[model samples]
Target chain A: MQEELFAPGHRGCAGCGAAIAARLILKGSGKDVIIVSPTGCLEVISSPYPESAWKVPWIHSLFENAAAVASGVEVALKSLGRKDEAKVIVIGGDGATIDIGIGALSGMLERGHDITYICYDNEAYMNTGIQRSSSTPYGASTTTSPAGKVSFGENRPKKNLPAIAAAHGIPYVATASIAYPKDVIKKVKKAISIEGPKYLQIHAPCCTGWGFDGSKTIEIGRLAVETALFPIYESTEGKVTSVKKVKRKPVEEYLKAQRRFSHLFKIEGGEEELKKIQDIADSNAKQFGLDQ
Target chain B: MEIMEGSRAVAEAVKACRPNVIAAYPITPQTHIVEEIARMVADGELASEYVRVDSEHSAMSVCVGASATGARTYTATTSQGMALMHEVLFNAAGLRLPIVMTAANRSLSAPINIWNDQQDTVSERDSGWIQLYAEDTQEASDMIIQAYKIAEDHDILLPVMVGMDGFILTHVHEPVELCPQEKVDDFLPSYDPAYYLTPKNPLSFGTIVYPSTYTEFRYMIHEAMKRAERKIIDVASDFRDKFGRHYGGLIDTYEAEDAEVLIMAMGSVIGTAKDAVDELRSDGKKVGIVKVRCYRPFPAEAISEAVKNAKAIAVLDKNISLGYEGALYTDVKSALYNENGPLALGFILGLGGRDITKNTIKSIAEKAQKAIKSGRVEKDSEFVDVGVL
Candidate 1:
């Protein structure tokens, strides 16, 4: 077995999907990688001074600027005449990637830097007490977008972060989930091989933030893909190259799996709200040919 | 030596420093320096990675990354661009990376004016970065070289902000001696960072520090700044041995050695103040100039030593502390806490690009004369250039 670049002892919550994705990412990256993380659950949990779960060269600065920092590391390596031997990877949560940090990410991609940018999309700012982020899917209840008497949770669709990166005409862009570890590893390896900017958005199901059974983390992630709620796909130069086909289960199956969405089942007009979620899944299936 | 724009001279000096990476984002009055650097990179005069980042925030972030990897890095921005970089500025210093920046000091907005002022860099006084102000275009060019040396000193591994007056110094053409690459090479060796981001070495940078260890890390930066006072002077002495000109150590003095009334200021206005002091001296007045070159690491001891004998000290500040007095006026007063010294008056002037004539300095000297005769001043601080209501 390959050595764990992300060591075993970490403060990550039990069955944290981000921790699993981080492990899989480190495994694919192997030893010749420098990781830059923005402020998030993974950063706080892995780094607490006296110990660090990162066995690789890693840095976590602010909530944003991971992509820009990665660009610096890449450019510095290239300048030092060692660009080929190492790879720069920026890992940040959805809030940092899709929202606050998108400008820096866009700059890095458009400048055509040779780096891999990873966004572990956990929907909300899990490290900051579950505040809603732009990546929060419509109808999901977060602390900030709590399902009060007259309100549904986040009132917007999840920001299409992968598509945003692909539109930069980068060399590679892919979406994966922790449920498919092998697939995640394969896509990451592919991204590292490419010469220019590559982006990966992983569906990281946070058990603590999403109020799910810790042991059912992988099961919840699989249901998300099966329902077409989190379509897994690869795009090259703005063109969708391939997608993981789904059997197209109702979104209710995915929603029923997490307590963050328990309100839609327990409240009045709950069925109607559940139907709206199904419409979103149906849209993703039709748009990405995920049902084919 | 050739006549060059202040920005071009700085660009040539940066090339001499041989930075491995430069992140460029244009802000007015700072655009010329970055443009020249870009041209140098394209024409093969400088072999460096010129990263064209989108905003000042990304510019600083890239520098933070490049510096962490032990690469000598450079960037230039002004006013609003500097404000955009506020968040990363702390990160850069707290990480103890020696990234050097040229902040073409310009006034901040509200009515949105783009002209020379010290307020932008002064507002970032507590960001833990060393702040240096230049008195002229030539000093602006020379200080960029000094900044890299002082910042990267292992004893003082902190980011340095080199401030030159917007349009006044940055846009003005002056004869500046562009130090040869060989001399700069001898002065600045290849940067060898004790800590860096490398896959082979495998270490973490900017990791989360609990409250238990955070204060100690911050204390390290404070200690570095305390140590920088000596390092800044040492680098200047070393720089002077190689290059024939000396841009004073910390605070540059002009005839303050034998004067009763001392006038003080930073940035290009000090150049004008010097000219005014010379004119006042010819008229049999004991007025002199104390050009503030290094603003942060506030140089309190240097200020005390320079103004000890002066009967009264007048500080012409381009930046006001709003409800309080001028920023430097406050620092100078605090430095005199345990010593008997001059009755210093703070005069706020030339804000938002209003011109600072030699006569403005004379008017300030007159104010000091009145305060010196009475051994008291009418007010703590007052504006000299804002039109009367």
Candidate 2:
């Protein structure tokens, strides 16, 4: 592995989840990799050229076409007969991966191309100033999902993307978090080694959008996995292979650390909201077999 | 060595140039080009990755990915297909990938005319691509070969558009001198993108730009385009030196000397206009023509010089702006304005897939020549053929 593919002088804000995810991904994929990034925070801050944090070859196309661009890289390598020599990886925000770029990713996967798609889900569209995204969690407060008198933040649950990618029957699909660098890097390495299309969803919490301590980026992400709000698991061709069933903690341990959910605590009858959050976490735990 | 349609000629040229990746969808007029290439690939005549994308948008997207990964890529499309791939087109240009595509010029919606016209390519003029309009099959075949070399030039890394008229040039069979594989190989070097997505050089692409840095990035793109103007000419000159063919960059002139009036046109209309000029010359009428090759770069200087000595100039456009004059008319008018030159006239002709006959050109020349001799402006700028309608 190259010592520092994504060098240290990046301008990512404190506790920036996407930045951490990028570092782990680079470390996991090692030195021989091409990265296709969609328009997002990590892309904006890391590359303000003529000074870039990346030490390797990188390309930034558009907001909704990272997967397609990565596919181009794959085909180019195939033409050069270098598919085995270099791995092609596409990294984008959840908004770009699950929403705008979904069709391209689906087509690429259906075509059974040699590529890996890594989506760093920060929940909302943070780069555009905390706007609501399809991946924004239920009861999350964004600019568009304000917690007004009658509103309880977001009304929709986070879109289940891994399940969707798994439905494609791709060779590998997994979910990881920036909190666990080893876990995220391991999954990335596994996906890269796979022959066919692979997908990875990395949970990276945003400090500015989630109203959490910027320094708590890693700790909060760990709590997300530990509290069972976010599960760490991998699947191959619609079949579950492995899952990280950690020692579970109370859901409040995860919620109390973030300011975006602080309103739920401030309101009267806060116990009901807390119960709903717990119910959601319990369902995820039972579904993914995260609870022993 | 055999005669072929413009589409087949382009396909043959593409085969000779040897693209590593070909991704495209079937669209009218443009379909035959991709179909022929697919057949060649299937027959093992061309060694490439032929991707049959679900849509035009995907076709371009796949091409972008393939090209970025270090493959020589190609595709072709018509009106609606070009419009559908609009989003990816800008990306290809902005990323500065040397992608070569053939756009069979056709009319836009809502009537949905898929005949010969320039509306499709003109709509994408500002897409930051090297736009070239071919006068015939030979030019179409030849321009593509030059396009690859010009686009891949380190100083001018931009996508190139080689446009032929739908149904007219794309469908009609004509005798085009096909360049042999060795000649083409010698002419066009393998595509080597300046910036590639390679593992040895791990880098993050597509960063979000703030207002403070946005202007500078756009300025760099602009500067690259300005640099392309010189590089295109140099590439064309190099092609002429090596292949014994010349595009002369920006614009190609025909019989402009000692002429009272000049007809400015683009695409296949240049062929018709040239024939009309020769016939009129035999009839003792002083008429010549100037064909616009590079529309995006506008070629303001070339057009100005070609029409400077003429008493009158008429600009022909196959696209109408609706409630206003044609797109080319505005550009040509601005190029000739207050230049101490002849009066420039705007003629909205052959739009909506209307055919531009030699008689139409002869009549336009007669009327324009009379206006120039009289030293008086015509009653109208737009000269529509009501007689034909």
Candidate 3:
């Protein structure tokens, strides 16, 4: 109810997790924040020339330069003696954050600009119809990484962007899920309050791209956290300070809920692939102490 | 007047403009300018946020963001750096950011050349930014101040690139009368944009344009470019009135009115062409020089009017469009398509730092005279001073 900064009537699909994240993010940051978004699903759906869904100041430049753009906005405010007037934030997707925009993101983090960069991680490039991105999970079938007779699905593991972000020696880095609205809002508020660059990656599931019921978006996100496949945690200055621990559920429970992983139940040699995926989750749990 | 390197003069001029933010990635010949700016910022001579970006793409992107945020922004890069910024250049212009940049004109590379040529900026002619070429260090310094005035005009809210020959002008020492801070503050007032990214209004910028209205947006940009032609001229007139120095409006001419043949060029080569014209006149050759200062909004009418009485024209281009003739030659011919114009010939020279001496200008004049005597061109385009491999 916090002023509904991300207004309704946007073109986001029903039960869109990124749409929910955008609203929750603005709710926490309030009106005195400028948002910079690259070319992604949220940018396309929210801003259509003469119409806009955002009540806060926002800008969308190119597909891979949101961090750099936000850097400019932050520095401009500082230069104009209005640094305290607004907090600059960049809301980009996994593809824009982990792949094409990594250089600019690294630059922004390295330069220590007073901004918070948030990546709504829906795994694949959902804006371009589910092409495989660097953040796409292993064994998850996508448009570009379709499960085939000779291939299982995505061949590589999801890139550990939080760790990469923390490597910059930034003040804060956090990972959250869209299911935990309060947690997402809290982390955003906390990140913005810190001085230098802070990165927050939220696991926002895509019902349309992940081949699941639109109504099950939040449920699927919760499953991802519960199964320990997407560890929810916060690191302050390279040290893990807080984590969302859960009694671990089998990775199959999470994989079985989405059609992207439905192929694993039917295909030959898929059980072994499923075991490999469980090993990945186990490793993540061990790394972040996510298992209760 | 103070004697200083072209790069330092440009930095001094930029300091006087009082930009709110500056972002740039250093490339050869442009490095000295940004480095000088950084020195001034460290010395407290200028109070601007200098963001040292990793690449030229980010540099231009930073300018777009700052300019959209209602801050006057500046940046500079050249050659491969400019090529790397190709897409962002189009984005900045389309967004109507009115960010001013100095393009230390250098040749694009396959052989990896880092020398003076107009090819770098010439390739970006269609990117919707107003392009102005400078003939010397003084003009290059003066144009930076004029560029901001022209670009930040609400009626002509388009980005501008002030092109100076890389190394040739950027590295040379010359006596430049740097404008006083007070005078510049009067000539170019602080940038106050009508639309900007502000929390008070909370508006969105650079939104997605659908096919339903994309063409209309493009057409509006085109219309704005057309309007900027007059704005460029008027700003130049105002600059001359205030500063007591004049670099002609669209095309500056030296004795072109009654000449039998006209020599046309841009950038620092104009200085050499002027000396060549003086010599040609003393020898009764009846030749004059026409300097195309503003390349974009391509000053066709002014060019045609300048060379209307000439029997032939020789256009010296430091940039070639490959497969065809020089880019300026193509534009000049198209400009004269409907008029009883001169028999124009194209001469590509001085590319990749090849020196364009006074002798080169004299020989080009001889070619124009030959075309006049024959009442036709021997060849539409030819490379000047090519030696055997």
Q: Which stretches of candidate 1 lie over 4 Å from their true place?
A: none
Candidates 1 and 3, the one with greater DockQ: 1
Model 3: TM-score for chain B: 0.99
Clashes of each: 0, 14, 0
Candidate 2 residue-wise lDDT, B129-213, digit = tens: 8898998888888888988988888877889999989989898888878888897887787876676666765545555567888
Better of 2 and 3 by DockQ: 3
In model 2, where do residues sit more than 4 Å from their true spots? Answer: A246-250, A267-276, B192-195, B201-248, B383-389
Scored on chain A only, each candidate's TM-score is 0.98, 0.97, 0.99
Worst 10 residues of 1 chain A by lDDT: A1-10
Candidate 2, fnat value?
0.74
**TM-score of every prediction relative to native:** 0.99, 0.92, 0.99
Instruction: Using DockQ, give the best candidate's number.
Output: 1
Those runs of model 3 whose alpha carbons end farther than 4 Å from true positions after fitting are none
lDDT per residue, candidate 3, B38-70, as tens digits? 999999999999999979989998998888888
Compared with the true structure, the alpha-carbon lDDT of candidate 1 equals 0.90
Q: Residue B70 deviation, candidate 2, in Å?
A: 3.2
